[model samples]
Target: MVSPLTVVKSEGPKLVPFFKATCVYFVLWLPSSNPTWFSALIKCLPIFCLCLFLLAHGLGFLQTHPSATRIFVGLIFSAVGDAFLIWQDQGYFVHGLLMFAVTHMFYASAFGMKPLDLRKGLVIAVLSGSSYALLYPCLSGAFTYLVGVYVAIISFMGWRALAGLQLIGAAWRWTKLAAGSGALLFILSDMTIALNKFCFPVPHSRAIIMSTYYAAQMLITLSAVESREPVEAYGLSKTN
Candidate 1:
C-alpha cells in the first residue's frame, strides 16, 4: 500500500521545473524565518537542486544540455561537504573530497588532454601548481591527504582544460575560460573551508567563499551549454 507521498515521489521526474522553482523559492525564503536553521537547509538545497537539474537536462527536459556531469558531480560533493561542515561533521569531509576528486578526474577526461601541446600544458601546470602550493599550508592535518589528492586531480584538469582552450582557440574560449575560473575558485573555496574547520577559525568566510564558488560553477556550466557548435557544421558529405 503506497501513500500519496510515495506517488508524488514516483512522479518527481515529470515535475522537475516545478520542483526547481519551489526549491529556489523555499531557499530564498529561508533567510527571514530562522537564519541558522534555514541557512543549513539552503546549503543542502543547492546539491539537491543541482542533481535534479542535471538529471532533467540529461533527459531533455531543459532547453540546453551542457554535458557537465563531471562539474555537477563536483557541485554535488561540494554541497554535501558544505552540509556536513555546516553541522560540523568531520566524518563526511573525507567522503566529500573523494567525491570531488572523482569529479576532477572526470573533468580532466572531458578536457581531452592528449592533443594539447607540451608547452601549453607546462604553462598551465606551472600556474595551477603555484596556486595550490600557496594554499597547501593552510589545510587541516586530517584533510591534508585528501586535499593533496584533490589538488592533484583538479590542477591537472584545469591544465588540460586550459590547454584545450588554447589549442581549440575562440571557438569556445569564453566557455572554457569560465569553467577554468570556476574550477580555480572551487579549489580556493574548499581550501578556505578546510582551514576554517580544522585550522584557523574565521567568521562568515565559509558562506561568502561558497557563494562565490557556487556562482562560478553555474556560470561556467551555462557558458559551456551556450557555446556548443552545431553538429551539422561538421560538413560531412551529404549522401543520398
Candidate 2:
C-alpha cells in the first residue's frame, strides 16, 4: 500500500508539464509586443519567473535522484540559452549555442548510461556523428570554432552514454528507457533549433524550438523521478 506522502509527492511531477507549458506561453506572448528598452526589462519578468520556477522545481527533484542531475543541468543551460536568445544581442548567440550544446551532451550521457550492451555505443556514435556531419555543412565561419568544440562534446557524450550502458542494473532498465527517451527528445529539440537558425530560418522557429525544449526538460525530470522512486522504494521494502 502507498503512503499519503507518496501520493502527494507524485502530484509534484505531474505539475511539471503545466508549469513548463505556462512558460512557453509567456515566452511567445511577450516578444510580439516589441517593447521599448525599458519596457523590455519589465516584460522579462514573466519569462524570468518561469525559468526560476523550472530551475527550483528541477533542482528539488534532482536532490533525491542523482541520476537525473545531468537532465536538470541541461534545463539550466537551456534557460540560459533562452535568455540569450531573448536579449537579441548578436554577441550572445555563441553563448547560447554553447549552453545548448552542453544541454545535448548531458542528455547523450544520460541516454548512454542505460542498461544496454556497450556495443550500442557504436549506434549512438553513428547517430550523433550523422547529425553533426549534416548540420556542420550549413554552419558558417562565424561559428566554426564554436561548432567544432560543440561537435567534440557531442561525440564524447555519445561515447559516455554507450560506456554507461554496461553499468545499468537489470531492474533499472525501464527507468533508464524512460529517462533516455526524454534525453532523446531534448536532442531532437536542440537539433531542430540549430537547423532553424543555420539552415532554414523558419517563421515560427522560436515557438517550435521552445515548445520541444521545455517539453523535453520536464519529461526528463519526471522520468528521473519515476525511475528512481520505484527502485528506491522497492529496495527499501525488500530489505525491510
Candidate 3:
C-alpha cells in the first residue's frame, strides 16, 4: 500500500516548479506594491502556473472520476478571479468576486454529491452567518448585497467540503483531509480579502491572502489527483 506522502511525492516533478514560481512571484510582487504593466504581467504568472498545476493533477484523475473535471473547472475560474482581482482599478473587482462565487459553486457541487455530516454543516452555517452579520454593516452601497451573495456561496462550499470528509473511504482519508482543510483555508483567505477591502486594512494583507489562496489551491489539486481509485480498466496498475 502506498502512503499518502508517497502519492504526493510522485507528483513532485510537476508541482515543484510551479511552487518555486509562486514563491518567486510573491517575493518580487508583493513588496513592490505598485501596479504597472510589467508588475501586472509578472503577477499573473504565479496564478497561471498554479492553475496549470491544478489542471495537470485534475486531468490525471479525470479518466477515473467525472467529478475531477469539476475540480479543474473550478480552478480555471479561480485563475480568472485572480486575474480580475489583480487589476482592481480596471473595473474588475466585481467581476473577480463573481468569478470566485461561481468557482465556489463548482467546488460545492463536487463535494455535495456525497453524504453530508450534519454537525459540520451546522458549524459552517453558524460561522458563516455570524461573519456575514458582522461584515454587512461594514460594507456600504451596492457592495453589501454583492458581497453577501458571495459569502453565502462560499459558506455552502466550505460546508460541503466538511461533509465530504465524512464520506471518504480509508484509502482516501488523507485526500479528504487535505481537501477539507483547503476549503477552510480558502474561506479564511476570502474573509481576509473582505475585511481588507471593506472593514479595515490588514497589515501585509496581500501576502497573507495570496499565500493562503495558493496553498489552498495546491492542496485541493492534490486531493483531486490522489483520491481516485487505480484505473485497472485503463491498464494502469495500482503502483502506477
- What's the CA error at residue 100 for candidate 1, in Å? 1.6
Which candidate has the top score in lDDT?
3
Candidate 2 lDDT, 17-70, residue by residue in tens:
457555556555665335344434333343344344445556655555544666
Tell me which of candidates 1 and 2 scores higher on TM-score: 2
Q: What is the TM-score of each candidate against the true structure?
A: 0.62, 0.64, 0.85
Best by TM-score: 3
Name the TM-score of candidate 3. Answer: 0.85
Provide the lowest-lDDT 10-residue window in model 3: 225-234
Best-to-worst ranking by lDDT: 3, 2, 1
Residue 137 CA error for candidate 2 (Å)? 2.4
In candidate 2, which residue ranges exceed 4 Å CA deviation? 1-9, 12-17, 20-28, 32-64, 104-116, 151-174, 227-240
Give lDDT tens digits, candidate 1, residues 1-93. 233466346544544553564457455654422336566666566556655655654554222323355555556666665555454453455
Model 1 whole-model lDDT (C-alpha atoms): 0.57
Total clashes for model 2: 1
